[model samples]
Target: MTAAPTHASLDPSGFESRHFGIDDIFYSRTDGRGIILAANAVFQRVSVYDWSDLIGAPHNVIRHPDMPRGVFHLMWSILGDGKPFCGYIKNKAEDGSHYWVLAVACPLEDGFLSVRIKPGTEMFRQAQQIYTDLRHRERNENLPPEASSDALLQAFESAGYSDYASFMTKALTEETKHRDIALQRPADWRLRSILSIKEGVKEIEDHAGDVVRIFKQTNQIPYNMRLQAGRLEGTDGPISVISNNHRQMTQSLADAVATFSEKSLLGNDYLIQAEFLHGVSRVQHDLLQSFGLEPVIDGQDKAQEKALLSRQQMEFVSMAHKAVVEVSDRVSAFSKICNDVRRLKAGLEMTRVMCKIERSRIAERVDGLDEIVQQLGKAQTDLDHLLSKMDGAVQQILEAAERLTQSRQRAA
Candidate 1:
C-alpha cells in the first residue's frame, strides 16, 4: 500500500459542512455547458438557493472551491462522449457551507440529469484525499486540468481499479451498498446471485485457459510417437497405427474445444455490465421512493419544480427499466453457452479415453510416452471439473436474471 496523501489544506474544520438526511438524494438537470435547467426540492433545500437563484444559473453556482477542477474536467470529457459520470463531489451552499454527494450524472434528451446521494464509503474517503492531492498540485505546480485528470486516473489504478470506467463501476456499487446498509435494506437476491456468477466466471475462465495450454502440449505427443515408430520398425509398426489414431481423436476434441473461448462461454461480457446496470436500476427505484416522501410544495413556482421532478423520476425509471432488460437478456445468453460447454465437456471425456487406449499399447518407455498421457489426463480432469461448476453457476445466474426481468415492470 502507498502512503496516504496529505490533506493539510483540505480539512473540513470551519467549513460549516451542511448535513442532510441519509435518505436525501439531490436531483438536477443541466445544459451542455452546465447551466442549471431544473432541480428537485431537495437540491434547492440543501444548496440554500431558491428556485430563482438556481435555475438558469451556471450549474457551478454551488461548486465548492475544494473540489478539484480536474474532476470537472474529467467529467466533461466523459459527458462529451455522451457517457454517464459517477463520482464523489463536494458542493457549496449559498452561505458557503458545504456538502458531499456521490453524484451520478446521466445523459438526458438534449441535456443531462444528475441524481446525487450522500456518500458513506471508504472509497469516498479515498476520493477526498485524491481531490486534495490534485488541488495541491494545481496550486503549486500549476497543473492543467487535463494533466491532473491523467494523474487522477493513475491514482485510481493505484487504488485497485483498472481505469476510470472500472473505478466508477466499483465506486457506484460500493456507494449503493453502503447506503443500503445505512437504510437497513437487505442486499437484493438478484444482485448477490449476479455477483457470485461474475466471480465464478473469472475462475472458470482461468481454468479454461489452462486447458487450452495443456491441450497444445499434447500436439507433440503424436509426432513424437511417429518418430519412435520409424526408429523401431518403420511406418508398419503398432506405434505408428496408435499415433495416427491418437491424432484423429485429439484433432476432433481440439476442434470441439477451439469452437469456444472464455468470451464465448460468457457471451461477450462476464456480467459486470449487467451487475452495474441492474444495480443502477435498483438504486434509482429506491431514489424515486425517497423523492415521493418529501413534502409537497406550495405555490405555482415551487409546484413547477416538483412537477419537473415527477417527470424526471418517471423518465429515469423508464430508461432504467429498458437498460436492465437489455443486460438481463445478455445474462440469459450465458446459460445457453453453459449448456454448449457441457456437451463439449462430454467430448473431452471421450478424447481422454481414446488417448488412454493408445497409451496402453505402447508398452516400451519411448521418450516417456506415458508422461504425455498423464499430463493430458490431469488437464482434462481439471477442465471437466471447472465446466461442471460453471453449469451450476450459469443456472443460478439465469434464475436471478429471470427474477429481475419478471419484476422489472412492477418495480418500475
Candidate 2:
C-alpha cells in the first residue's frame, strides 16, 4: 500500500469550498487495503482528478486536514470487521478545495464500494462541531488518535446514540431524508419528483389489488344466499321470500363492489399518467434552468408565454388530483356497501334462527334445510371477514390520499 500523506505535505489554505450538486452521487471501489481501484465520473469530477491519477492511490488522498483522525480510525475499525460504515466526511479536492459528504462504505466480496452524497442536514452540522472539537483535542493536548476516538464515542453518547453504529445509521438516514426534501425545492427540482409520483402510483396499484381480492370473496356471498333461498322455497312460506330478498340484495352489493373496484383500477391508470407528467415537468424545468438567458423586450414576452404554457400543463395534474378524490369517494361508498352487506347477513342469521324454531314442522318437507342454514352461517362469517379487509384497505387509501394532497400543497 502507498504511504498515507503527511499533514505538512498536503496544502490546506487559499482555496474555496467546492460543492457537489444535489443530484450528484460519487462512487468508488477500493481494495481491501484501501487503495482506490475504480472511480465513477462524479467521483472524478468532484475530486478534480483524472482516472489515471486516482486509480491505485490510497482512498485517503482526498482526506481533508480539518477532519479528525479519530473518525477515520473508527471507520477503518468497522470496515475491518467486514461491516459497512457511514459518517460525515470532509474531503479535499485535488486543488485543496474541500467538500462535505455523507459517505457510506460497504464491504464487498473482493473490495469495498463507497458511495458519497452531499450532506445538508442538521445532523451534519452537529457532526462538524464534534469533529472540530476532536481535532482541537488532538492538536492542543497532543492526544493520540485513539484518545480522540474515545472522545468521539462520548460525544455520540451525549447526543443520545448508544454507540457508533447507531449514530452512523441515524446520520445516514437523516441525511437521505433531508436530501429528498431538498430535491423538491425550486432550485433542486429534478427526477426526484418523478420518483415520488411513481411511488404514489405503486401505492394505488397495491390498494387496487386489495379491492380485487375482496370482490372475488364477495362473489361467493350472493351465490350462497341464492342456494339457501332455493332450499327453503316451497316449505317455509314467508321465510323463503325473506331469503330471496336477501339473495337479491347481496347480489346487488356484489355488483356495486365490482364497479368500485373498476374505478380503483382506473384511478391507478390516472396515477401512472401523473407520474409521466411529473417526469415531463422535471425535464422542462431543468431545460429552463439550463438555458434561460437574460431577458430583453421580446425575450421577456417569450418567457411569459412559457410560463403560461407551464400553467396550462398543470391542468393535467389538477385532473389527476380530481381522479384521486373520486377514487377516495368510491372507497367510502364501498365501505358503506360493506355495512349494508353486514346488515343483510344479520337478517339471514335471523332467518336461520326461525328455521330452527320451526324445525319439527318442516323437517320432513325440507330436504336440505340444515345444510342451507350451515351455508348461511358460513357465508356470514366470510362476509364479515371481507368487510374487515375492505375497511382496512379503505383506511390505507385515505391515508395515502392525504399524504399526496399534502405533498401537492408543498409543491405549490
lDDT of 2 by residue, 1-412 (tens): 3233333313347364555787666566677888987655567778997667788899989888888888988887887896567888888888778888888776666677676778887778778777777787788898787888888999989978877766775575456557657777433222243334445435544654664564454445444545555565553555565556655665666665566555444254444444433332333333334324423322124455345335533654565566566656665665565555456557657756765665556646655556656666665666566556556666766666667677778888
Please give, for residues 245-329, the per-residue lDDT of candidate 1 as tens digits.
Answer: 7678677666555755544355324355555555555556665676667666443255565565556555644554454455456
What TM-score does each of the candidates earn? 0.83, 0.44
Superposed on all Cα atoms, model 1 deviates from the true structure by an RMSD in Å of: 3.6
Global lDDT of each candidate: 0.70, 0.62
- Give candidate 1's TM-score: 0.83
Q: lDDT of candidate 1 vs native?
A: 0.70
Which residue pairs of candidate 2 clash?
A: none
The positional error of residue 361 in candidate 1, measured at the CA in angstroms, is: 6.1
